[model samples]
Structures are given as C-alpha cells and as structure tokens.
Target: MKTKKYTLLLILASLFVGCEDYLDKIDNIEALTELDIFTDVNLAEDYLDAGYTYLITETTAKSNQPDILSGLVMSDEGYPGRYNNSVQERYQSYANGDYLFLMDLNLGVQQRDTPNLAVRYSESWKGIRVVNTFLENVDLIENADEETINGLVGQAYFLRAFYYHLLTKRHGGVIYLTENLDLNSDLARVRESYESNLENILIDLEQAIDLLPVNWTAGNIGRPTKGAAMALKSRVTLFAASPLANTNNDPQKWVDAATAASDLINYASQNGLYQLIDASDAINLDVGHGGADLFVSEPEKLNNYRKVFVGPGKSKVLPQEAIFMEVNDNTIGNGGLVPLPRTYLTSGYDIVKGNFNPMNIGATANFVEKFETKNGLAIEDDPSYNDQEPFINRDPRFYNAILYDGVPWIVTDSAPLNTSGVADLAVINENGVLGVDLHDPTSPANQLWRVRNSTGYRIRKWVPNGFFLRNCCNAEEDFYVNNMIFRMSEIYLNYAEAANEAYGPAGKAPGQSLSSLDAVNVIRNRVGMPNVNGMYTGSTSTLRERIRNERAIEFCFEAMRYDDIRRWKIAHLEENKKVEFLEMRWQGGVSAIYPTGFSFENVEQVNLKKTFIEKNYWWPIPSSELEAVPDFGQTDNW
Candidate 1:
C-alpha cells in the first residue's frame, strides 16, 4: 500500500512542535511516526497539546499577547503610553472612527497578517480548525484507553468553546464551524445570531465539563480542568446576558449566568479544592515573609493579594485564585512576560537604572483614584484621604499595583533600594526648583521623578522588586510568573454581578443560597476590606454601580475592564472620559510640608476623548475575512 501523503501522527507532531511551547510540554513527548500516534497512548495525547497554544498571555504591541495591559489601555482604567507607535495608533484608530480593516488590532490571536501588525488577534477560525481536526480523528487512536481519550476529547471541546467565545465576544456573532473544513469545501458562511452562538458554546462547555477531571496529575498541570470548563461557561454566559448582547433585557439570561458561576463556586467549596487565597492564611503559612518584599519591608507580610502576584516556591506556585492561567516563563523574552518598571524609570541622563528601554507608560490619575480608601470610601468621600499625601492610607491594592512618586524604586546611590525597603524615596520636583534640594530633580540622588515620564505612576502588579534592570527576556533566577486567565475571585465577582442583576442587591436567585451582597463580601472579607452589606444599604441600582467598581479594582490588569464597561453598555461615557493626573508641586521646600509636603493644586487634564459611536459597542469584522465571504455582512457601524 502506498503511504498516505500526510499521516495524522506526523501532522500532529509537526503542529505540536510549531506551537508556542504550551508550557514547555510537547518537547517531552516521545517521538513517534505517523502510525505511532494512534498506537501509543502518550503520542496520541500529544495530539491535543497544540490546542493550549491558542491562549493569550501579556499584551505587547508586536506580540499581541493580550492581557491586562491591552484591556487597561482600551478602557478608562488606564491609558496607552505608546504615543504614535502601533500600540497607541491602533487604540486611537479604534476610538476615532478609523476603519477596522485599516488598523491591525487583535489582542490575543497568534496569527500575523503583516510583519508588525497582528490583525488577527480576535480571529480564532484557525484554532477552531485545529480543535475540530483533533475531534474528527481522535476516535481512531487504538493505544489510548477510555480515560485518556475522554481527557483529550474534553480538552478539545473546551478549547473549541473558548476560541468561539473569543470570536463571538469581539465581533458579536461569527460563523460557527463544528466540523473541520476540507480543501474542496465551500468557504461561504454567514454569522449566526448572538443568542444561538452562545447556546452552541454552552452545549460544548457542558460536554467538556462532563468529561474533564477536577484536576490533572503532575505532567499536565495547566490543562483545562472541570473548573476551567465551568469558569469559561460562566464568563461566556455573563457576557451573553450583558446589556449589549441581551437587547431584550432577559431576566432568565442573568439567572443562567449567575447559576453558571455558582456551579463552579459551589463545586470548589464543597470539594475543598479552591478558595479565596486569604492574606491571613498565606501569612500563617509564612510563604512570603522574608527573601524580598514587593511592598513594605516587614518580616511578616499581611497582603495576600500582593503575594498572589509575586510569591515564590512550588508550594505557592498556583494560588487558589487561579482557575486557569497561561503558563510561560516570565524571565524569558516574550514568554510569560510583564513590562519591567525599571525600563520605564528615566528621571535623568546618566541614571541607567535598568538594562534596556526607558519606562514610558504608567497608571493614569483616574485609574489610581478608582481604588477605594482603607476605610472603603472613595478618595473624595474619605475625610482622612489627605489630598497632600494622596498615596498614603489608600487602598492596599493601590500600593501593590501602582508605583507613584515617594514610592521607592529599586535603585539608590548606596544600595539597590525598592518600595519594600526604606532606603530611598522617589522625589519628584521634576519642575526643577532651586532652593528645595532634598532629592532634587536635577540632583544625581533623585532621578526617580514623575516629571521625566508621561504618565506619573508606573505599573507595579506582576513586576518583580529589588532589581534595577532584569533583562526583557533574560528571566533572572528562572522565575516564571504565568498570566492568570480565570480565577475563583473573578467567579465570585461574576456571581455577585449576575445574581444582583437577576434578583436584587440583597436578594438571591431561586436555587442559590448566597445573596449578591454575600457574594461580594466573600471576596472582600478575604482581603480584610469592609463588606458591602455593612457599608452600602442602598437599592439594587446603587449596589450595581458598586459591583462594577469592585470588578475594576480586582481585575484591573487582568484585561476584563474593557469588556466589563462594554457589556454594561456604558462604554460611550467611560471610554470618552478624560485621562486625569495628580500633579505634585513642592509647597515650600521639603521642610515646610514635612513628610506630606506637596500641593495637589494641579489636577492635570489631558483630552484623550475618543469617538465612541453606538456602533462601536462591537469591534468590526476584519476585511480579510469579509472579502473571503462576500455575503458575510460587516458588523454594525464599521
């Protein structure tokens, strides 16, 4: 018999090899020939390995990894500091009525249309094709037993559902393809209705949930578990039931979304598999006591939230908050990467604090103010929130997530200093005053000033401390911080929002035991924040606003802000809002105001107003796909 042109095993092997590491797993699989994939259990399992590569990590302009940074830049949460570059240009074009086809702006997809522009970020047809192909032939595997087969099949279904979710979320409704397409098959297909699209996705997720295990063994740490399937379902349903998608305002849809979220929460709680990683509990374990501190230089750290971002060791590897994460080495270039703050710290000419690149982008004034005070009141509302010392006594998350002036950078003349250590403080007299010489802007000791940069504050979340310049890809100490996708905390918030919408603020859905307020409190109590039930005794509308704000703070850099505002149908107002900044001018040298001696007199205003049309509720369908299927109509207002 003449050998088949391309064997399924060989095809899968080549595909797996080409995949973006997929947590460095494919390399471990034994090499097998075309027939070996079907006859060998390990090789057959490797067939499903490539599907994991479709997931996104950190967001960079050229890489288009698509995580917290992209979402922040797109929404009112933060501003894109990449002025005039592709990252800045793409965002500007999206906002200012620029044609979607003309601009290349996909946040997560790996495919590249051109060299620099990743136009296919939202496009998942190729990924779906790979998944469909696996499903079509997986049954032929002779060596894999029922359990192995079920695991692979379940993952394929979950990935297919995820890819479809990515597509539908971006372009509203997309053409759903269940079976893999052939060479001679017709490419013509029209977009489905939003409701129908979600229904089909839900069906796939249910199947995945039924087949997937609660957790995987050693070799398969990052594989989609039963929780992941349910988490995706909950998130997908949450969006489907949102105001933008649910045009009819269906109460049942909200119930469905809430129920979906509650399913995972209930299961996790009952099984004792996952819970909110409490600060007190993490501290009790003494996981993050010493070594190096991200925030304050105390021996016993109290912030579990900050520990969730940067704690070391295998025991602390995957926090309970992580339901699903994109596994990559943070130290490696472009793999599990976060923007280093040192690269951004440029206050003077010879102050080469970091290895390469100057830190440009930072936390916008509006984003910084979004965090509630320690007393759980808005900064403006909190009487103790000193305008002079705006950074002090603010939300713990603010200190952990943002790097403002007076917040120490990891560089000093005597020793390598950081926020955790009290050696050096960032003195921003960037206005260049003559008499006030303590850590002056012009002086060599104080180059860590905000006047040298565009956005006054720098991003602190997911960045390592105590290092002046870690190479972009060098990855010191082989430290890898994976970008978390779905976590228990998000599910808690999802339940809070969805249940509140379905029933009322304090009310619970038909089958649920916890009220919306209770759901919000579950997350807040873990972080030692005041509960919503105790603070806000307002109506459902007021609670709804509070729930939205909670989501903003919790999921800040995780990339949910852009979608949350859009789904809430308040994008037009939020996206068009001005980017605000707090300007700190010296009052009368450092001695007059003492420690808190600065003027909040100047609230710098920048007009970052983008053209937000009603049609902008959904991103435009890419023109390349449009040309391929001429019958497929473009999204509204494109």
Candidate 2:
C-alpha cells in the first residue's frame, strides 16, 4: 500500500514539476517529496487539484475515447454505431453480460496501458489517497490564512467523498480509507457494508458543507461550493434510499433523502443562488434552433432546455441553473459527446471535414418512446397522438434532445441546401442518392453505415445549434461547452422521487411544502409541457414510474440513466431487450399529412439485443483486490 501510494505521488509530482519548469518556481524536481508539497500553500493546492483528475467529466464519463462506447451506448438509450472498432467491441462485450470483461474494463487490472480506461476502480483509490494526503498535512502550511486553509480543507473533504461515492456506486462498499495508509497499517482491510460506507460519505459531505462557502468567486468558478456539497448529499441519500441499497424499503431512508434534497432547495431559494432557467431567458437569444424544424411550436422553451447542455462559453457567466459543472474548454473535435458528422456531406458542402470516422451515438427507439406527448401523456394513452407522424407535438425536450427523420442536419444562417433548395437533412429513408437506407446493401449511403443518421436517430441534446464539423477545425467557430455535473433541475427530481417514496405523491416530508407531484410539474412546466397526468399521479407506485421516466428524458445523455436503472433494480426488465430503430422510406409526393414524403415504421435491429442479468446489477470486485484480501469476498454471484 505504501509503495502504490508513493507511485501515485511520484506521478503527480512529476506533472507538477513539469509545469514548474515553465513557471520557474520549484528549485529541485528529483529531490521534491510529499512533505515539500505541504510546506508551501501553492504546491499543496496543486497537489489537491490532482484529485480532480479522477472525476468523471461529461466527455470522459461516457466515452474514454473520442466518439465511441459512451454510457448512452451502453445503456438502453443508445447503440454503438461503430461496430468494427475494438473499443466499441469491448463495450459491447461488457453490455452483453460479460461479467469478466466488465471487471477487467472497470478495474483496469489487465488493461492499465489502455487509453480509455481513465476511470478504473484502482484509479479512484489513487485520487482518494491524494486528497487524504492533503487533509492530513493541510495544517502544516505556515503562511496561508484561515479562510484559505478552510477552503482547501473543505475541497479535500468533498473530493474524498466524491471519489468514495464513485467507488461505492460501481463496486458497492469498498475498503474505506480516510488517512494515508503507511506500510505498517493494516494492508488487508475488510470491505465495509454499503450502508456503513454511505454513512461515512455523508459525514465527510457534512464537513464539506460546513467549511465550503456558499459560492466561489468568478475566478474559482468550478470548485465545489456549499450548494455542490448539499447537492451531492441529495444524490447520495437518494441512492441510499433506492431499492438496490435499501432492500427493506425503509421509509425513513426516503425521508432522509427527501430532507437532504429539500434542504438544498430551501437554501437555494432563500439565497436566490439557483433557479430553473426559464423559457423567457432564451426568448431574446440569437442561438439557432438545434435542428428542430422551424415549425416546432414554443421554440423558446426548446432553446431554453437546449442551452442548459450546450453551456455558456467563457464569454458568458455560468447559468444560475447549473449548481455545479466541470469546467473545460471542450469542443466537438476532441472528447466532447457530439458525434462526428458525415464526412462526405461536409466535403460536398465545402465545409472542412471533422475527425477520423463518421461514428455516432445512435438513440434507440426504446428511449425515444419514453418521451410523453405535448399533453404530458404517454403516446399510447394520448388519443391525439399520430402514429405515422410520431415526432410531432411531442415533448418539446424530445425535439431538443433527439434528431429523427426530416430534421435539419444543421440550422445555420445560410445553411447549405441540396439542389432542390431544401436544407441538408438527417433523413433515414430509402432514397439512394440523398437519404440513408438501413436494409439496402448496395446503397451509396451505406458505405459508412455508422454515420450521423445510422440508427435512424442521433442524439441532439449535447450537440448545440449552428454546430458544424467544420467548427472542430476552425478556431474562430470552435464551440466550447461546459459539462454540468449538478444542477437545480436534478435536485428537484431527486426531491420528487424521495418525497414520493417517503410520503405519497401529494404528500411532503416533515415541514416541507413541495409535494412529489409539484416538484415534477415544476420541471415539466419549465419546458412548456403540461403537468403530470392526473391518471398517473394518483398513488406513489404509479407516480414512481412517471418520475423515473421524467428523469430518463430530463437527463437523457448526461450519463445518469445507466446507474439509475441499476439503483432502481429495474435493469433486468429495461435492459434485457431488443434494440429498435425508426425505419423510414421516401414515398415521393409531399402533402400536409405526408410532409417530406416519408413513411415511418419501428424495426428491431437485427441480431442486436442488450443483455443484462441479475448479477450485473453490481459490478464484480477485481480479482487482484480479492486475491490480496481473501476475506473481502468477491461481489455476489461473480
């Protein structure tokens, strides 16, 4: 344990020393030790920042690589389009109940040299150790003021909790280590119970909340705040109350979760620190409609929701809606979630080609159907829903989050158009020259079957308006967006779920005014959608399904769904099923009813069914770790 700890410290120290050459600050690189870092405030702060490296940022959360094998692809929400890629194949194996592969991939025991294995289980321990070192030695700094010391210590507590939360979510209760372990310390510690581990995490979070400021200055924007700690507490408690963790269905657990969420809500409301970004906020903005047809009603509401994901770049202040975000100057070219656009189409339009392959994270029809219609009722329940025109008058968020047939490829001020004067389209019809075909083998569009419109649908939530493949290569138009980790909307949903389970749909936790139904409607109303349907909100059981579906839609590709289904213990039902796509064909002669002259049909992807077994709910413990500590038995059924 001491040797491993020193290795991690050396790696971080090497990085710090490399930067020191440019700053000309540190005198000795080879002789620098852990104690030296603590002697100076700036060096100690830099050491603390190394812990942030392990956090799952938006770009790395799903795809450890460029545009392949994202969490969206792993979940029922999407499909891995680049089937031939080795990385995607690895993800495919893990998604198909390959437990050993999952253990190897997550633990990185055998694949440490792999590029995308950034969030391995062992890496998290390294991060925990970095912060633990900070907490142990932060008092040694001499010149730093009380406020500075407190803030740094607060960040260390928050980071330790954050890393432990990551480990707990994936591997259940791991060996909880707070102090930096030395060689003499017990090397073979027992893994604690999940509940006990969660309690420890809550203790650290409470300390973080006590020490952290309400908000940091603009210069320190991305650091955790009091609200961030509170938000994390809300998340932790919500998971603790979930069925996977609380198998006994303890109502008190739900109450605790609801109280945590409501506490944050009350604090934000009183301080005016955060609020849901209103539809009116985007009314005067000049941003383009993110591929939504020009005719889509209440475009302002759509833009409002879209803006939340495609964040305000460095030019603008962070939106009040985002309680916490991973600050990075990310563009579509590098690690951003936006799928690579079709190269041929970009070249034909005289736009600079984007990166290597036309790979995409294709949205599954299973996920598309989860969205309720404009009236806030499921399509099967909504009598006005048009089966043939499935995309119309649905949830405004659907338009903002998904790109189906007939949606514009890009909505620029002077968008390139085909010879017919129509804007370039993401059509998946049977047109050999213009549209794509899922079945036709000889079609020219099938050359790279994994292009933007491959699965008949592409994710639009993270892809901002007026975004082009050219933006990746053009510095002038480079689109920089921040990844939001915690926001007000999520807190609302957390409160709603816990409140619903603790009390009834209309009931609230002790001393709280907001009901579960009210909390959900607040999210729905922001996007101009009607409130939760009366039919579904009558009881906690029924409303539980609605709130889950609301979370599925609201946080679509934000990398929440994978853990969500697992924690709810519904992965077996939702994940082990055939993946479906929208099969559309061009039928010529356009009309009011047959606009774009296309017909739609739901078709299952051939030979593709996502497999999730009972054992998959919890990831298996790494073989090496279990080998070292034989008493720490492997995860159940592995």
TM-score of 1: 0.80
User: Would you list the C-alpha lDDT of every candidate in the order shown?
Assistant: 0.60, 0.67
lDDT of 2 by residue, 1-638 (tens): 01121332211222212123212344565577656778789988887887787665424532223433445655678764543335456655665777555555544323322323234465676677677777878888987999988899999989888877877887788767677655455555577888889989999999999999988876787899999999999999999999999999999999999999999989998899888877633323222323344443225545666766653233434677888876654345454433222211111221222334334566788789898887789988989876666777677778767765544444333333332222223333445344431223443653433333346666666654445444454422334354678999999999999999988999887767899999999998887777898999889999999999999999887768878988998878844256787766667756667654676677777566767787788877756556655776777888
Clashes of each: 7, 0
lDDT of 1 at 613: 68
Off by over 4 Å in 2: 1-27, 57-64, 106-118, 280-301, 311-316, 330-359, 411-450, 469-478, 574-576, 590-596
TM-score per candidate, in order? 0.80, 0.85
Candidate 1 has its poorest 10 consecutive residues by lDDT at: 9-18
Best by lDDT: 2
Question: What's the CA error at residue 172 for candidate 1, in Å?
Answer: 0.7
